[model samples]
Target: MQKSPLTSTGEALLRGQLQTLKTSERQRLRHVLEEARAHGDLKENAEYHAAKEEQGLLEAKISYIESQLQSCTVIDTSKLNTDKAVFGAIVTLENIETEDKSTYQFVGEAETDMEQNKISYRSPVAQACIGQEVGDTVSVDTPSGQIEYEIMDIRYS
Candidate 1:
């Protein structure tokens, strides 16, 4: 499979989650399973069965995270150029029609958290902003309609 791009922050976040799962989460599950096992027979114990199922899901998640880490190319956002909007750039824009302002960080897929205003580099807004500089107007086709935005500022790090 082709390696996917990831920001250094995203890589660190994934590594932290993996560590938590391997240590605290695993230990907690083991304790729960031990407690369940002491309750009754293996075949009829609902708690034991549930714990086993949860353990399977946890293991699957761990495996998925490990694979993702292995298949990613982490890029440090701080080393990028701030002159033009590009991957790992935090771009500030102003809506052409409404005059509303918004800021978004264009990052790799793994760091696309809407709540944090981090958008995927492959997203429409990011694609429109890429290679554009301040004062450049970009049009994006959304589900509602085409929206125009002027780039106000671009920052990296």
Candidate 2:
């Protein structure tokens, strides 16, 4: 399978989640299963059935997380080039039409969080900004229409 990219921070977050799932989550689910088993006969036990379904789903999620962690490659941000809009570079963009400006950090797919102003390198904005320098203008096609942005700055930190 092709390896997916992950920022160091994203890798750490996933690892933490996996650890929690394997330890505390598993222990808690085991207790829940035991409680449901004590309720009575397994033939018509709704609580037991529901708990089993939930436990299966939880185990599936844990397995998925484990696979994802194995298939991801963590990237080190500090060693990357900051001269242009690339992975790990924080780019400030100005809307050519409205003059509205926003800054976004280009990160791996797993690290994309809108609330944190961190976008994936594969995203349209990052795709447009890639290999671009300050003062350069890039146009991106959106559902509404095409939008233009001027590269204002690029920083590593």
Candidate 3:
């Protein structure tokens, strides 16, 4: 199986999620199931059916997270070189056409949060920026059109 890259923070987040699912969520669901079972007939009890469905979904999520954790390779950003744009690097860019500036942190797919300016390394923008140094310009094709950005700074934290 191909190993998926994950940031140390991302790995911790996944582990926390797994722990929550196994402990608090599982306990809550068991209580819900027990309450549903007390409502009598299993065939016609909507509450019981709903609880069972929720339990199944939770279990599936737990299993999926476990699988992801097992196959993940955690990358320590602090130990990496920041001379060029790379995974876990915080890169600042300036739009060549509009002169607008933006900052983004390249992370694993599982840790991507656009609202937080965290992008997946596999994303088009990150792909274009990877291996590029400061002052380098990269053009990426977007849904609207091709946009060019010049790298201003690269930092690893």
Candidate 4:
């Protein structure tokens, strides 16, 4: 499988979620299933059916998270160069048409939170900004139209 790039923080968060599923959630679900099984008929027990369904979903989540952890490459942002926009760089941009400024931290898909100004590296804006330096203008095609942005600064933390 192709490796997915993830910031170290993103990797840690995923790992923590996996740990919780393996340790606490699995045990809790198992207990719930056992309790439901005790109070029922095999075919008509609503509690038993719900518990079984929940267990299936939980197991699937655990499997998915494990797969992601196995296939991810953790990137340490501090070691990256700050001279150009790259994965894990905090890039400041100015909208060329509207002159509005915005700052975004480029991260992996799992860590992207638009409300926090974190964007995935695969996003159109990040794709356009990657490998670009300050004063460089990048144009990205959007559903509405092509938008232009001027890179103002790049920093790594």
Candidate 5:
């Protein structure tokens, strides 16, 4: 599989989640399974069945996280350009119609948090902003309609 580019912070976050799931979550699930097993027969024990299902889900999540970590390439944002929008660049844009301003940090897929204004590079807005400099007007096609934005500033941290 192709490796995805991720900011150092995003990579660190993924690694941290993976570590927590592997150690704490795994341990907790193991204990839960043991407790459930001690309760009753395997055929009709609701607690044992639930714990086994939970264990399956937990293992799947750990596997998925490990796969993402294995296919990640960390990018250091400190040395990136602040003049143009790019991966790891925090872009501030003004909505042409509403005159509202919003800031978004372009990050990898694993770290895209709409609530926090962190968008993935593969998203429409970020794709439109890539290679665009400040003061440039870019349009992104959404499910509603095409929205236009003017780049106000680009920052790298």
Candidate 6:
């Protein structure tokens, strides 16, 4: 499996999620399944069916997360040079068309959250920003259209 680059924070978050799933979630789901099974017949019991479905989903998620963890490579941003944009770099950019400035922290796919301004390195914006330094202009093809941005700052954290 190809390893994916993950920031320290991203790796920590993934580890936290894995721990929660292994301990709290797994135990809770098992208890729920037990209760559901005790209720009635498996074929027609709504609660039993729901719990079984939930178990399947939870197991799938656990497997996927485990696979990602197995292929993850935690990247320490502190030791990396800040001269250019790279994985784990927090980049500030100005949209050339709107003159609106925004900041984004490039992170692993598992940790990408748009609300937090964290984008996956494989995302269009992050791809454009990669290897770019301050004052460099890059164009990203978005669903809305092609947009251009000027790199304003790059920080490790």
Q: Give the clashing pairs for model 4.
A: none
- Candidate 3 C-alpha lDDT tens digits along 64-137: 99999899899999899669999999999999999999999999888889999999999999999999999999
Better of 2 and 5 by TM-score: 5
lDDT of 5 by residue, 1-157 (tens): 8999889998888889999988999999899889988887889899889988988998999899888888999899998756778899999999999999999999999888899899999999999999999999999999999999999999999
Q: What is the lDDT of residue 51 in candidate 4?
A: 89
Error of 3 at 17 (Å): 0.9
List, residue by residue over 1-157, the lDDT tens digit for candidate 4: 8888999988889999999999999999889988988996869989999988998999999999888888889999989856888999999999999999999999988778999899999999999999999999999899999999999999998
Per-model TM-score versus the true fold: 0.95, 0.89, 0.95, 0.90, 0.95, 0.91
Q: How close is candidate 1 to the true structure, as a TM-score?
A: 0.95
Off by over 4 Å in 4: none
CA lDDT, every model vs. true structure? 0.94, 0.88, 0.94, 0.92, 0.92, 0.90
Question: Residues 49-125, candidate 6, lDDT per residue (tens digit)?
Answer: 88888888888888988888889888888889769999999999999999999999989998899999999999999
Which 10-residue window in model 2 sums to the lowest lDDT? 77-86
Q: What is the TM-score of candidate 2?
A: 0.89
Model 4, residue 144: displacement in angstroms?
Answer: 0.5
Candidate 5 matches the true fold with a TM-score of 0.95
Give a tens-digit lDDT track for model 1, residues 42-121.
99999999999999999999999999899999989899856888888999999999999999998878668999999999
